[model samples]
Target: MNQNVLIIGATSGIAEAVARHFAEQGARLFLVARNSEKLQAISADLVARGALEVATFVMNANETDRIPQMTDAAWKVHGTIDVALVAHGTLPDQQRTETNIAYAIAEFRTNAESVIACLAALAQRMEPQGKGVLAVIGSVAGDRGRPGNYLYGAAKAALDTYASGLRARLFKSGVHVLIIKPGFVATAMTVDLNLPARLTATPDRVACDIQLAIAKRRDVLYTPWFWYWIMLIIRWIPAAIFKRMKL
Candidate 1:
């Protein structure tokens, strides 16, 4: 079956990879992103990659007010979205955000509030349809807050909770809500960050994990699989020791 797939933040590295994977399966795509040029570029690439149909929308995802309208527009274009992925976020400078309260709140709004808004919009439409996949690209940083990137971690943590709640509510309705937690992904977004290359994953690798998760209708997934045990150890640490150690 050629599915109708809607991808928010479709221009992002991981989202683009996912789009390509879906396109290879001959899925019809409705891609939304903030950059017009990038959105169009991705659309063309997906078409070339064998997407049955590829449509593009340009909108700033962080503008929470516009997400509902955007989701509605995407649904109208596709008739019904068989799958939806929300994959837009920023990795804020932890020290800068910690000192600047306003900046911190803005980051939160972008990473957390906007995602919740998008999910809610998609959920509302999918509930009536009775079947669909709603997935979001979250981070394992959210599993536990650390001094290095607590701001980003906290936002993702909120999203993780939100996805859990949505999954429970949508389960009976047959709308599967999936949360994908990636550890360290080596994308443009993380190019400058100091990270272990061995521990990081490529967009294509993460995309494969997403495909499996969607196919299996999983509720929560930690990409690379090893992150599950890594996070387990981190979460298992005693609060006193965890607090004193640098992450």
Candidate 2:
């Protein structure tokens, strides 16, 4: 069956991989991104790879006022959206954010506020239809605040909490909300960070995990699976020890 899928932040590595995965499965795609050039390229690529239809939109997601309008337009393309993925975020410099309130707020707006705005718009549409999958990419870092990137971690943590509450609210409406917690994904987001190869997954690999989670209607997902236990251990550590340890 051909399904209508909307991908916000569609130009990101994981989102692009997800688009290709869905295209192979014969989905109609509505892709949104801040970069018009990248959005057009992705749309063209999906069309060539066998997507049923591909629509592209360019907008900065941080402009909360624009989200509802953009989301509605995207959904209008296929009449209904079977799946929507919110995959945009930033990895801010920890020291910069710590000292600069402006930088901190900017990162927060991108990582958390913008995501919530998009989700709220999608939920308004999906809840009425009684069925749809809303998935967002968070991170394992959200589970705990490490000194390394606590600002980014806090933003993701906020997203995780919001998604949890949203999932419960949408349950009665039959809309499934999925929160994806990825440990170390080797996308451009993590290009400069020194993460272990064994622990880091490629965007394609994480994309496959996301597809599976959506299909299963999983509430919260740790991509690569083992991150579930890793987070469990981290979350259980005593605060004193956790604070002192170099993450």
Candidate 3:
């Protein structure tokens, strides 16, 4: 079957990588993002690279009121959405969030609420179809709240829980729900962070993992696989001693 994939936040980083992956597989695409220029460029590139079809929607995912209208228009273009990937997120500075409540709130809305709104809209549409996949790009930070990036972690934790519940709710609906937890990705989001190569994964690697997870109907996956064991250990650590140690 010719897959119709909708990628929210398709302009850069892991989302762009996933877009290219699906385009190479001859899937029709609906690329949604805030940047018109980037979206057009990506759409053009995908069409040139063997995408069955490519469409773009320029809108802020945080605009809850606009989600249904935007999704309806995209569905009209593609006919059916076989897969919807909610990949829009923000990683704000930990220190800045302490001094700036506005920044923290913005990050929370962008990383959690916006994705929730968009996914909810897509889920409603996919439920009736009885055959679709909803893949969300979450982070391993949500596994346990560390002091370094607890604000971001907290927001992701909320998202993680939401996705898990959505998966359970959609179990009998025939719509697959996948929650992707990437440890440290070498994307523009982590450009300034000093991360070790072993702990970080590339965009292409993450994209491949996403495809595999969707194909296997996995409910949750940790990119690179090693993170699964690592998080397991982290989750078992004693709170008193774990709180004192830096991650």
Candidate 4:
């Protein structure tokens, strides 16, 4: 596992867990996130924890224009990115988004548009290399929209579809594109949701699953395994009855 790795949103709870897993494997890492101090701190921590070497960049991922530059920097430092994970996103307030159109648009951009931008930049680089794992943290909510969080679900759905298409496009190039659909995770982003403990996975657990999926070159991953069944049931429900019942 001492491969060259790049993690956009290196400071995210899920991203950090993945970084730690790679670091333990003595991987070389290039990290990107908005916070300069946090980026440096995580880089130091990962290096201390056995990462062969760590490089970092500070950029707000929402700035799509900066994505190409960021991707170039990662590739320059690592030479070949054996694995790259795009994991930045915001969990916006559903209630507020219902009324505030501007906020809703911004949230969608944060979760969907920015991810597309990063994917485009990374795909161009990986396609030429002819081998690498390109993974993104999608969500089970994307399987279907629910009244509680359709806005967020829609954004993840976009990523899932985009990744699916990209996966096919890169297949001939020997590149593997993986979309990670995580259920409830006990991360800083979801502390207030009070997700069921039985359903919620720890970031470490998700990271571990991700590591295996990448090794296996799986197309889509449902972490904890059970979420695949859960979302399947939800997706199969007929519109009439499903719309009447609360999710």
Candidate 5:
């Protein structure tokens, strides 16, 4: 309830839900997102919903060079963030991304490089504080590469690798790094997809899971809970048969 939270991609479906949860818990928030108008709307809503304080920064997630500045400003306002959520990413069209090398690289930059940049910048501050949670939003797609969205999967895989190592590195420093892997979330990003109702989860449900994971200082979270077993099964399938099957 007393957490000072800093969320990058704050206006995102999951991030916004997390912010509202934080607000309900009486936490002060520093939100960063590319959309100023959307950010303002969410911030105002959070304030009205009982956020102890609300601050914002407008930044396109692709602008990796400005990440340090964003971190600096967030820490300036919040002093020490109890939780920092990196939640910005895009789910690009697999066919289009696969065909266009330049487009593929751009999508990769958005989903992977920018996140790596944030991890580098945020760690310097969190390490010194010797406390808090560095929570990154990864995906179930990262567990393994599939024909459907391998490009997006690769980006998430990179994030998982980076976070896995960083979790160990920061463990001794008293800062917990949490990696959240959500599967088929009902967000704007996945709105057009033909997601199965039985498997899909709402942003609010994910937000609850994330905060709970952070509180417990868990290393990783497979939201909706069942993704853990689902991914486990998928990861175990022999590559020979796995490659032939459609995901």
Candidate 6:
């Protein structure tokens, strides 16, 4: 059977990588992002690269009311979405968010609320189908809040909790819910940050891991796997010492 995959935030970075991976698998794609030009370019590229089918939706995820309309259009094109990859995200400067309440609010809305609303809409449709996978790209930063990017971490933490609950709720329905926690992915999101090469992951690597996890029906995955152990240790650290250290 041909698979239909819907990927949010497909214009750049990890989402784009995920799209390429699924396209290579001959999955029909419905790519979503705010930029129409980029989405069209991606759609064309995917079709040229041997995708079964390709479509694009230009809508800001922050505009929650437009979600149903956009989703319905995708459903019409692809018939039924077999996989929904919720990978839309924004990473604002942490220091700026500290002083600007508006910036912090925007970050929360972009990273947390928008994802929740869109995923909830998708889940409602997919639950009744009883044969779909809902995969979200989260961050290892959510595992333990560090002094550097606590705001982003907090938003990701909320998403992690939501995905966990969604997984439990949808288990009996045969709809798989996966939460991907990638540690320090080298993408546009982390281009400015100095990170250790040993610990950092590329988007292609992360995308491959995501495909494997979905195929295995894994509930939660830490990209590179070693981050799972690393986060486990970090999660156990005492707040007194953790707060002082710059992680």
**Model 6, C-alpha of 92: deviation from truth (Å):** 1.6
lDDT tens digits, residue span 209-230, model 1: 9999999999888998999999
Off by over 4 Å in 5: none
Point to the candidate with the largest lDDT: 4
The per-model lDDT (C-alpha) reads 0.92, 0.92, 0.90, 0.94, 0.93, 0.90
TM-score of each: 0.98, 0.98, 0.97, 0.98, 0.98, 0.97
Off by over 4 Å in 2: none
The regions of model 6 sitting more than 4 angstroms off are none
Each prediction's RMSD to truth: 0.8, 0.8, 0.9, 0.8, 0.7, 1.0
* Between candidates 3 and 5, the lDDT winner: 5
Clashing pairs in 2: none
Clashes of each: 0, 0, 0, 0, 0, 0
lDDT of 3 by residue, 1-247 (tens): 6799999988769999888888899999998999999898888888888898898888998888989988899889987889999999888798999999999999888888998998899999999889899999888899999889999899889889999999989989999899999989999989999999888889999999988898898989999899999999999999989988987
Q: Can you give the lDDT of residue 94 in candidate 5?
A: 96
Model 4, runs deviating above 4 Å: none
lDDT by residue (140-217, candidate 2, tens digit) is 989999999999999999999999999999999999999999889888888999999899899999999999999999
Weakest lDDT window of 10 consecutive positions for candidate 5:
60-69
Model 4 quality (TM-score): 0.98
